[model samples]
Structure formats: C-alpha cells, structure tokens
Target chain A: MTTALLRIPAVRLATHLRRLGAAALVVASVLTAPDPARASREQTGDDDGCARDGADLPLAGAHFAPRRVEGGVAWDARFVVASDAASSFRGGALRFAAPLPAGEELVAAPGLGAIVEDGRIAGLCVGAGARSGRTVLASFFQPLSGDGASALGAPIAAGRAVQIVDTSVGDARLELVGAPLFEKHVGFVAPRAVSPGAREEARRLAGVREDVSASPIYLRGEDARGGLTVRVVDARARAETSAIAVGVAFAGVVGGLVLAARRLRRAASVERADALLASEIDAAAKEPAG
Target chain B: MTTFVTILDIACGRPIPAEDSGRARRLQLVVFALLASLAFAGAWGLAAGSQAAGLAIANLYKVPMVILLSCVFAAPAGLLAWRLSGAPVRGTDLALGFSGGVFGGTLVLAVLAPLVALYYQSSAWAGPLLGIGSAALALVVGTVMFVRGTIRRLPPGAPKLAALLPVVVTLGMQLLTLLQLAAIAAPIFPERTPFSGGIDHLAR
Candidate 1:
C-alpha cells in the first residue's frame, strides 16, 4: 500500500519534502540565490567609499581642447570612465562653478545620457554592454566667456562624481589633460607656435609630466574646493604686451590731437589773412572803375 | 622733405604760393598727401589687425587700399560736377583739398590705432565697437577739413556753395562706396557683425 501511495506524484513530492526538512530547504535556497547588487560591489572591491579610494582608482579622466568660437571659447571635452572586467561604471554627475551660458546644451555620446539642471549636469548614465577598459564615456562642448587669444587663460572648474553599480561616489576629482594644439585666431597650431621659451615656461608652470610626449601640458589644477581649475602662465605675457600697446596708443592719440590742434590754428590764421587780402582787392576793383 | 612740409602746410589751410599754384605743383602736392595718407592708414591697420599675424599683414594693404579706391572712384564725379557748376575753383585745387582731407582722416586713424589694439586684446565688445567708432569719427573730421580746404581756394566773387559743388558730389560718392567696400573687406573687426558683410549679410 505504501509503495502504491509513493507511485502517486503528490505523495512522492510530500515524501521528498519530509526527507529534506523545511528549514534545510529554506537555507539551501537562500545560499544558492544570486545577489547582483552585492556581487558587483564585491567584484569591484569599492565597498569602503568612492572618494576615499580616489587616488588608487580615479573615477574618470577628462581631456579638453579650447577653440575660439564666434562670441567666446568652446572647450571640446572628452570623459573616460574607469572600468575593469569585473566592474563597470553605471553613471556620474558634473557641476560647474558657474552656470553654463543660456541656450547651450551638453551633448553626450551614444550609450550615455546627460541631464543639465541649473548649472550642473546630473544623472549621467553609462549604457549596458559598454567596453570595460579605458572606454570614452562622454564628450561635449562647453562654452566659456572670452574672445580671441584672451580665451586661452579663462578660468574653468568642474566637480565630478561617479557611480559604480549601486555605490555612487561624490567628490571624485578627474585627471585633466589639455590637447597638444591650441587655437589661435589665425588657425590651430602647437604651443611652440607661441614661442619656444613661452611654451617651455607654460609647461613648467603647469607641472606637466615630462614622460608624456603626447600631452605636453595639463592646464587644470585642484582648487581649495576640490574642483578642477585652469592655470595659464602664457597669458601673462599677452597681458604685458597689451598694456604696452595701450600706453603707446594713448600717447599717440594725445600727440596727434595736439598736432592737429596746432595745424588747425595756423590754418585759421592763414584763412583770415587770405580773406582780408581778397576783400581789399574786391573793394579796390569796385571803387569808381579804379 | 621740403616738399612734404609744404604739402602739409597747404593741407592745414595755408595760402598756396604763386609759384606753387600751377597745375603741376598742385598735382605734386596731391601725390605727396596721398602717400602720407597711406602711411598713416597703414599704421592704424597694423594696430587693428594685431589680433592675428595674417590679419596684420593683410590690413597693412587693406586699410590704405580702401582710401585709395574711394578717392579713385570719387575723383571723376567731382571733376564732372566742377564742369557743370561753372565754379571759379580749379579742378587741381579740388584734388589738392581732397588729398589733404584724406591725410587728416588717416592721421586720426593712426593716432587711435594703439588704443584699438589694446582694447582688441583686452575687451570683447569694446574692441570692435571702438574700431567702428574711430573710423566714423575720422570720416566726419575728414569731411569738415575737405570743405574748409576747398572753400579757402575759391575766388572771392565765386558763390561758396556753388564752388563746393564738386566737394559735395565727391563726398557723397565716397560715402556710398565705402559702405559697400566695408562689406567686401569683411572682418575689419575680430567679431563679425551685420555691417561686416554689408547689405547681403544683413539681408540674410
């Protein structure tokens, strides 16, 4: 009878459950199930904190190339998120010191979305299936206030935060690299075009690494608030030249005005004399057929 | 050097000497004044175009060429007006006065050149605006000087306005021509404006 009962499907399932107690079943199920959120954190080993491990693993790296636009300067920016086979970036945020100019949009690359709120870019996300190692995450153009060569030294500040899976890290400073070429009103040229001496001095002031031949200069530095800032030493020379030109121009204007005034005065005297002589001649001619 | 000084004196409204009153002497004075005008205009262009080396080189010729072309285009109209008006003023005398006006105008540009360059490097809006302002100021001053120089050469019996007929026609033609020329010579300023490209740019 027992054998016959065991042949029934429901009775067999009950017998199996009885053999493996409910407690044992629950424990096995819990141990076998996957926890994707925790697994991601464990694989990346970023459990401690994002900002604390910034030195060991930078959240992202940024590169900027400044070019002269119609009204101001446009900084062509590229961002590369830190990633490895076991872990990948999920999203990030960027806040500028000053609000971006009105009507300007932050254009992000495919597989990423940039959301601009007020002056900050928030809720930036990396799409699924993105490459893990040294992948370019996003790129956009940022407008700055300046014209011509003067735009070269304009101040720049941006706060970076990166998200890895469920763990979001704020205050993750980025490594900034300036492009090898700089834009002049005439066209694009290397920093050496500004004079070899100036280029050397600019590189020294910016503390660019000597080994990096591809990027000779890094215009950005960390500020008091932990945001990236731009430093341009070559702009000082430009300012000095501008001052001298203005001084010379002012003196020229003054001298020219004085000279013009003297000439006008002399001309007035000549005109008066000529008018007197002409009137006398006319009077003589009209006087009784003289 | 002496000839240059004499030309300068005449441009400043001094009476022409009897020996210098001949058509040949008047033509010489006009040529000298024109050369001087070019030099002054070139100086201003250097300062204004200092923003870029290529632009600086171009302006060296561009600024003076604008003045030269304006004069060239306007001279024939002035001569025609002189014949029609039946004025006692000689055409050569008119030419001399016009040349003097050109010199004066260019002198102003040269004087303001440094300031323009300084501003161009330092300020965004002010630089271009100052450039346009300086050019306009030079034009007004030149117009006044032209009228004064021409009137001084007129005979006592000649109607002043009638004698100035050629001057009026030349000035009008120059004004019209400069407007178009400014368009052709676009980018006198670092920033492009509606006026830079002239009527076509504005229409678009």
Candidate 2:
C-alpha cells in the first residue's frame, strides 16, 4: 500500500499543490486588504483632515478696488493663484455667492471662460496651463448699481484638479480631481479717492469691528460653499475701550465720594458748635435776674 | 452756601434754630432743598442714561420730574395727616424736613453716579440691577433720615406717634407715586426690569 501511494502520478500531485497554493493566496489577500469604509470614517472624524488633504491645491487671493464707471461704481477685481513648487493646478472655477451686477461682463484671462446663468456672471474658469508656484491670473471689472461694496461676495475656487508629487510614495504622483478649494486671502483696496475715514466708516457700517492691519482677511474653514467667514481681531480694542471707560468712571466716583465725605464732616462740626452755642444761651436765659 | 449748610444740618438731625423755625424761613429752606435735590437726582439720571445719548438727554429731565411730581402728589396728604394727628409739628417744618430727606437721598444717588455709568457700559445684567439697587438704597437712607429729622424737630412733650403718622403717610404716598412715575419714564435702564413697567408689568 505504501509503494502504491508513492507511485502516484506526478501531474496529479502538482495540480493538487497548485490548487492549495491558490486558496492560501486568496485568504492572505482577504486578511491584509484595507477597509475603504473604515478609512473614510476615520478621515471624516478628523477636524483638520480636509485642509490637510488639499494642502497641495493652489490658493487664491483677491483684491477688489472700487471704480467710478459711467453708470455707477464698478469693482476692479484682481485674482492671484499660487501653490508650492511640487504641486500643479488646472481647470477650476472661481464662483461668487452674490449674483453679478446686471449687464456686466466678466473679462478674465486668455484661456479662462465665464459661466453665466440667469444673466449673471456666476463664475470664471481656468481652461489650460497647470498653475504652479505664484501666478497672477487676470484682472476683471465688475460693475454694480451702487458702490458695489455691499453687493460683492468673496471669491471661491471650485472643481480644481490638483497634482502633487508624493515623496512618501517614492516619487509617485497623486492627483485630486476637482475639489472645492478656498481663497487664502481676500481684501478691499480702497480707491485713491476714498479717504481713510470713509473706509473706516464703511467698515463700521458693515459691522466689521476687526482690525485688518495684520493681514488680509482669509476664509477660516474647510467649507468653501459657506462663503467667506471673517475672524474678529478687534476684541482687544473693545476690551481696552471698556477698561478705560470703567477706570475713569471709578476714579470719578472715588474722588466724588472723598470730597462729599469731607464736606459732610465740616458741616457736622459746624452744626455741633451751633448746638453748643444755643445751649449756652439757654443756660444764661434761665439764670436768675441780676 | 448758607442754605446748603442748613440743609446739611437738617440731614444730620441737628435742631432747627428758634429764629429760623419761623414759617417763612422754613418755607425758604424747603425751596432751596428742593432745588438742590433736583440737581443731585438729575446728575444720577444722567449717569444711568449714559447707555445712549438720547436716553441721557431724556433722563436729565425725567428723573427730576418724577421726584417733583411725587412730592407734589404726596405733600398735601402728609400735611392733612399732620393736622389730624395734632402732632404740634409745624407744616413748614415738616416740609423742610421732607425736602432735606430728598436732598440727602439725591446726594447719595449723585455719589453713586459714576459707578452706575461704569456698570452701564461694561455689564448688561449688572447695569440695570445696579441702577435699581442704588435707587432702592437711596430710598431706604432717605426714609431713615426723614424719620430722624422730623422726630428731632418735634416739640418737647409732643406724641412721637402723632408726628410719625404724617411721615408714614407721606412715605407711602411717595413710593406709590414713584412706582407709577417710573413706569411712565420707561426705558430708564438699558434693559427692562419689573420696576420699569411698574405694577401692570408685574401683574402680567
């Protein structure tokens, strides 16, 4: 029986071994493969994960200057696109929340196009040339019915394809296809005609009490669709004002109390003297006639 | 200056001089005290209203007006009670004492004015509470001063209860009148309180 078993066909033995090996390989792959669902849930759990993921995307900067057009005031808007040397960006739209002024045309860069809907210049697109490092896109003129300051919204970059060289993966490049990216900087360049006082008044009217001297206001969150959210920097100003007002008021109160107390004491002493004099006079009047 | 000194004497419970105790002189003293009271109360009102310019201007008149009106409405009843009780206390002397109390109370308010202004701009909750609290404290101090001043001015052998009758009547009437007047002068505080709208608000 042992001799018969050893004499089994070589082809059959090889076939059986191959089948076992295939089954083992399948089990190993099943155990080692990463779970896409678990990875996605963990990424969502991190608050700053979105920002970290799009770290290679090109950042947008916008400066709006008011211009006196024939009809009214128009905003001479300029957009600058920039990114790190290892990253490239192409084919993105700069969208605005507020509708463009009626009958205004968007004149963007040579390769870019305008997305108009309902007679409004809704967005601008980058068609060609992968932007890397710092690049000034184009200056566009947007007209408004009035000053245009109140009507214009901050610009947001959306649907942009970003490609970054992944050093962790040994020169492997990663391409993110069409993710909404936020502007790094947004600012209002007051026209030469506008006075500093007027600009301050305008800012006050808009209810922006933050001091904008440090840096141009930038979008703070990962959500590009929420428009521009400004971080208030003038809390120190408010606190200082309150401190000064309270300090002066307290000083006045203390001084007044001291003065009043002194006057009251003087009055009390005079009253006591008067009472003593009155008593002395009464004593004399009551004495026997002489 | 002499009148101010005389008012201060009354607040301190010093005896009224026999010569100045005449009806005419007492009336003159009352008038002077009234004016001084208005000035002091007005200063406090100005501080309480520092939350807004319009309110500040309005309070300049409203606070004094409230005090004056309360006095006008309450003094007649007080005088009648004095006569019925047969307190042997002269009406003019009573009026002088009442005005002195007013002066003392308003002086306290003026002293706390800067504190009120400080709180008004700095704290939302504390501002209105402090305004109302200071006023209430002034009322208590004024009442104590009123009772002491009047009792001291009473002739020897006069019934203390008889003299106190008018004092009680006058204070009760003044408080009632003041509550209504404060309601009429709505928005005295940055935010409304139970006292701001008076009894009707409390009922609601």
Candidate 3:
C-alpha cells in the first residue's frame, strides 16, 4: 500500500480517481447485478442454529451469485423445462445439520463416494472442515416442471448433466427427500420426511432455534461472528439484453466502414477524373484564342 | 477532486475520498465479473430443464445473425471509447482480446448451452449468454484497438468532429450485418434453427 504513496500526484489525479471510481462502481454493480432473489434478512431462526448471515460469507461460499438466491433462497425447485431430451439426468442430495454453514454437507451419499462432513460448496468452504472440497455439488429437487429422467439425488458429474432443487443457503440437501432425490420415484412425502427429520436432528444437535414454517421453513440464527440477524430480502436484478445487442450492432459497423471507405475512394477517383478533364478543356480553349 | 467537487456542486452525485477509492476497483472487477456470472447463468440457468430446446437453436447461422445485429448497436459506442479516451491503449490488442473474449466466451457458452438446457430454469442462459458474448467481444476488440495505438491521441479537444467518425462507421456496419442476417434467416428459420435436434442436427 505504501508503494502507491511514493509516486507524486498529478494535477488531474483527483479527477482521474473520481472518474475511475465512478466507472468502477458501475462495473461492479453491473457485474454483481444478478444478485440472488432470496431475502438475506437476518430473521430469527426457529431454534435451528444454522450459522452466519449469507452476507458475511464470501460469494465463493454459496457458489451462486446473490441474484440467484434473491428469490428467497429456494428451499427446493422442480424442473419445468428441458433444453434437451437426449441429455442424461442423475439425482443428487446433500444433508445438512444445524450450526452448519450454508452449502455444507453433514452427511454424504454414495454417488460421490460417501464424503464425510466437510463444508465446501462448489470449491468454496463454508466452515473450517477437513477435506471439505471433496464434497460434490449436489441438487436435491426434481428437474422443475420439465420432462427428463431424474438423476435422483446423485453426485453432479462435473460435465454430466443434472438439475438443482435447493436455492437457499445453510440448508442441507436431503438425498432421500425430494422426488428427484428418491430412488425409483419413491413419491415426494416419504423422502421429504426422512430428510427433514435428519435436518431437524442436526439442528437440535447444534442447540439453535428450530425453523418450522409451513411447507418450507427458513432457519435464522446469530451470525458466526454473532452479528444481529436482520431479515434482508434480496431482489434479483434483470439482466438487460440490449447491452449485448449493442455488440452485434458493432460488428455491422465494422463492415459498414469498409463499404463507406470504398464509396469514398470511388468518389475521390471520379472527382480526380473530372478535374483532369476540365484542365484539358481549358488548354484546348486557350489554344484557339492563341 | 475538482471533478468530484464540481459534480457535487452540480448535485448530480457526491462521494468522499474513501468512498471514491473503494468504489473504483470494485466496480471494474464487478463489470468484468458480469461475463463470468452470465456464463454461469448460460451454462446452468433455465437450461437445467430444457437441453433439447437449446440444442435445437444452436445453429451456425445464429453466429452471423448475432454478429450482424450486435455490431449495428455496439459499433458506435465502441468507436466512442476508442476515439475519446485520453489514456493510452493498444487498438489491435484491445480488439483481439475483446473479440477473443467474446467469441471464445460465446463458443464456450454455445457448446454447453445445450447441456445446460438439460436442467430446469436453465434456458434463461441462452439470450443472456448471446448478449454477453456479443458485448464482451465488441468491448474487448474496442479496448484492444485503443491500446494498440491504432487511435492516435488528439490535440487538446482536437477530435472535435473527427472523434465521432469511428462511431458513425461502426453504426453503418452493424446495421448492414443485422439486415443481412434477418434477410437470410427469414427464409430458413425453424429448419435453420437446431431446437428440434432432427435431421438437420445430424447434418451438423
């Protein structure tokens, strides 16, 4: 930091700095504009002490942009559309217990080869757990509202196609919970109860408040740093397509320029020809006078 | 800064020293970060559920169409950036990097877009990916052009009318390309599009 101080300041340094700062702000907001739609509100947990507010966690922790979760941390989602019928599907689930960090899996299923409780979400660690990076990215719900075979709560095979069911942070993905998580389509109820119980047990073990809200419940607890839990609802900003459209337009311009240059060259050629002809005509007229 | 103070006086917006510095670096990083985010969305968003639909639309013809349409819109601003900036930047390198970034990014997105459509809520990735790819390409190219020293620095306020010339040229090119693609695609849509993954898909 001190190295920056050694340079003498320019007269326009302030102006440059201000402009740079403004430009940077615009860039940052535009970059992160796709923030999650989930409410990051520090709402109280239902005796389910999960962990810190999602805000405190580095974005790397969630493996999803804030805009992705701004939709109120989807407890789970079902596939609604399929981009390809020929794509493969695999079911995957991750189980979570209380006092756990978001995306942290307390238990693992066999698809990823039974990883122990390590808190890593998509290469990001939620807590200090040994060998947590081994945890595979798993989804717990059926492909929402779509027509494709469910992998059924299996390990996400990096390049292998799959779907996500859980959208919220600090929530465990239950392999035995959602329809996609179950083997042979064991119906939704059977697996959900099993997974919910496991999640509740983990919450109980953590000695935090229990979250029991309707079909889906969100657990609020003191941040790991013990900060107040302020319920923050996030709104995902819409990504504008016009900006991209601008690029397409730019390509056209490059072509147009070539054409215009050619046209200009042609006109210049004609103009030169006219000037030469006029000079010759003048010479011819002067000869007669002479 | 004088600019800051002046802007403050204008009451358009105001920022303190600390706020200014903090915001600057973050903003650039964030803007660049958008491509990454858009990439993720493209690879996995609505496509999580609709792979076939995505593949069905992935046609070579789409590239020309994109190039045509985006150039029409982006060329002008890109030219502005090239012509107006006081900072020294290479024009060719900027163009190569920008175009590379855009095309490479687009190609990557295109390769995976079909797969992404396999999951639910992933289809949203397509348009955004296309848009980002286009912008990323143009900006990268523009920046490269600026950096390569293709655009000479103007004397104090010398660009006057000349500064905008590049932009005008860019607009013309973009308009022509889009018009061309729309014309070409009009006759061979649905069939030209790969959303169906039928005989044409096998032809690819």
Candidate 1 wrong stretches, greater than 4 Å: A1-290, B201-204
Which of the two, 1 or 3, has more lDDT?
Answer: 1
Task: List iRMS for all predictions.
Answer: 13.2, 13.8, 20.7
Predicted candidate 3: what Cα RMSD to the true structure? 30.1
Clashes of each: 0, 0, 133
Model 2 scores a C-alpha lDDT of: 0.59
Q: Report the lDDT tens digits of candidate 3 across residue range A1-290.
A: 66566554753687899999999998887777553322121212121112322211111111111112332222221111122311221222122211222342313222222222332222112222211232223222212222122122222212211222222223212222232323322221122323545435433432234322111221211111121111221111111243345435544554554455455444444554566677778879889663
lDDT, candidate 1, A1-290, per-residue tens = 98777679887789988878977987887788685322222111122222222222223434444544554334454444444522644433333334334444445345443434553442233343332454433333445453222212212233332111100001111122343343322211233335545444433433333332132233222221332233333323443454354435434544553465455544444655666687788889889962
Docking class for candidate 3: incorrect
Q: List DockQ, one per candidate, in order.
A: 0.04, 0.03, 0.03
Per-residue lDDT for A123-227 in model 2, tens only? 554433423234434344544344212323333344222111110111111112232342222133222333445445433422344332222222211333433
lDDT of 3 by residue, B28-54 (tens): 222222233234333432232233455
Candidate 3's C-alpha runs over 4 A off are A1-165, A168-290, B1-70, B78-204
Judge candidate 1 against the unseen true structure and give its global Cα lDDT, from 0 to 1. 0.56
- The residue-by-residue lDDT of candidate 2 on B88-141, one tens digit each, is 787877887798888889989999999999999899888888898999988988
Q: State in Å the error of residue A286, model 1.
A: 27
